[model samples]
Target: MTPMLLVMVAIGGTDILFALDSIPAIFGLTQNVYLVFTATAFSLLGLRQLYFLIDGLLDRLIYLSYGLAAILGFIGVKLVLHALHENNVPFINNGQPVDVVEIGTGVSLAVIIGVLAVTVLASLTSARGKAQNAVAAARRHAAEYLDMAKDPIRRADIFGKLLAEQAKIRALPEKYRAQIREEQELMALLHRAHAEHGSTSAR
Candidate 1:
């Protein structure tokens, strides 16, 4: 999955293999090539929309990978069994040639739908908890600086130190350094303004 090509190949191969089993299974059912073609055409048309929906929901479902693995494993076994049945392999213990391929396809589809439902629900719950945690952390950081403002000289020193720390953090973004410097200039201007007002009022 780390490599894009690997994932594409794996999914593409599985899709083609599944289609092979599907065409035979459908033929066994209706024996109408035209009907099969129609169904397949419609399916292809709809699948792109389904893929978009699945991609959007994938991140929410914590169990998505596990569910998909179980489903694919089940389908793969069924496909092998169906192929063996078609070949008249005797090891099936007289099991009814019950079209296990179609059954597997149905089960895999149901599991995918169920997993998507659960994943969406779980994601919404997780998102709420994460939002609350972020707010609490920000509040805690603000309280730390509020404590620093208790003594005037200490406040002034800490204010300069905090500005430097913020500048270092902001400098990485390039534009942010200019913004931080402007804030520092504004702070200095305010201090000078206050000193001038105090002197004039005393006179």
Candidate 2:
């Protein structure tokens, strides 16, 4: 096969593996093969986009792996319970169905969607919160250094540190980049002042 064909085959494999759980999970709602097939098709169709969306954010969300595991576990438990409810094994429950309530397909769908929504929201919120906190802390440290900068040498040191922090924040497309710009402005002023009064500025 051509390289493109090989790549397509690999991606198809990945898609099939990923959808394995949902194939059976949807059947829990109804034994209607057509309904199950339609629902799974619709669901996986949207997942192609979702895969990229989550892939970009995987680095930001530290607990994403745990969240996915929880989802799979929940589905596995649901399927097991369903099997027990439809029990036909002669060795268990006298070949009778389980007495416990079986979760309906609608409820299963709702719970799965709810958990996924919450997981994505929580991950993004947490990642943004930590980023904000770091920016705030950098601001506070820069302010302290500015206050303590009585001599030109001390001021230059403060400017260096602030510029370093600025470089870090420049990658984030937010208000923090503006704050870094302000720091760069201050650093330039300090550099000009030090150049003009070189005699006393070094000490």
Candidate 3:
């Protein structure tokens, strides 16, 4: 969709084609204009809300583009099959309609929902695992430097390196951060204790 249009352009020209097909389909089922208007209105309203819910999931679904293309292709093939079944072209099928199976609304909806659920679940699971690994790796890095040396200057050097690394890391769970900070504070106290001892022994 275009971010903005110089003119209205009939909802970017696509709406016009959809309207042509939908209007006839609704009219074939019902002549009541009011019923048609309400049906279309509610459908659009529901779809708008569904789009919001699915928007964030777009990035997570790595195969979204492929999935949508597959769906559109399936619908195109079905339309082609339906057309051939009722085809009236004299040369093509001798003006006779052939029998063909149609996809039901229930089956279509179920398949769509199943695909979406699988993708979303897989994405969320992958994200969680990555986050856990990141946090674990950060903690390991911090712990490695924490107990490396007992010399005050060396310990402070290690602590400074950890601080620098911490700044580069992404957002983590608060509890993990708190634990790190607590260890850092403990290390600071140890440094101060060593400093005090050095001063007293010099006296």
If scored against the real structure, what TM-score would every candidate get? Answer: 0.33, 0.54, 0.41
Report the number of clashing residue pairs per model: 0, 0, 0
Candidates in order have lDDT scores of 0.51, 0.65, 0.55
> Candidate 2, residues 3-71: lDDT per residue as tens digits?
999988887777777677577666655779898888777766776668866664664565567767776
Angstrom error of the Cα, residue 152, model 1: value is: 39
- What alpha-carbon RMSD in Å does predicted model 1 have with respect to the real structure? 16.8
lDDT per residue for candidate 3 within 10-112, as digits (tens), equals: 5434444454445544443444899878766665445445555565445345556656565555556655666777789888778887677765555555665
- Looking at candidate 3, what is the lDDT of residue 34? 100
The order of the candidates by lDDT, greatest first, is 2, 3, 1
TM-score for candidate 3, residues paired by index = 0.41
Which of candidates 1 and 3 reaches a greater lDDT? 3
Q: What is candidate 2's CA lDDT for residue 84?
A: 93
Report how far off residue 99 is in candidate 2 (Å): 1.1
Better of 2 and 3 by TM-score: 2
Query: Clashes in model 2: which pairs?
Result: none
Q: Which stretches of candidate 2 lie over 4 Å from their true place?
A: 28-30, 43-50, 127-203
Better of 2 and 3 by lDDT: 2
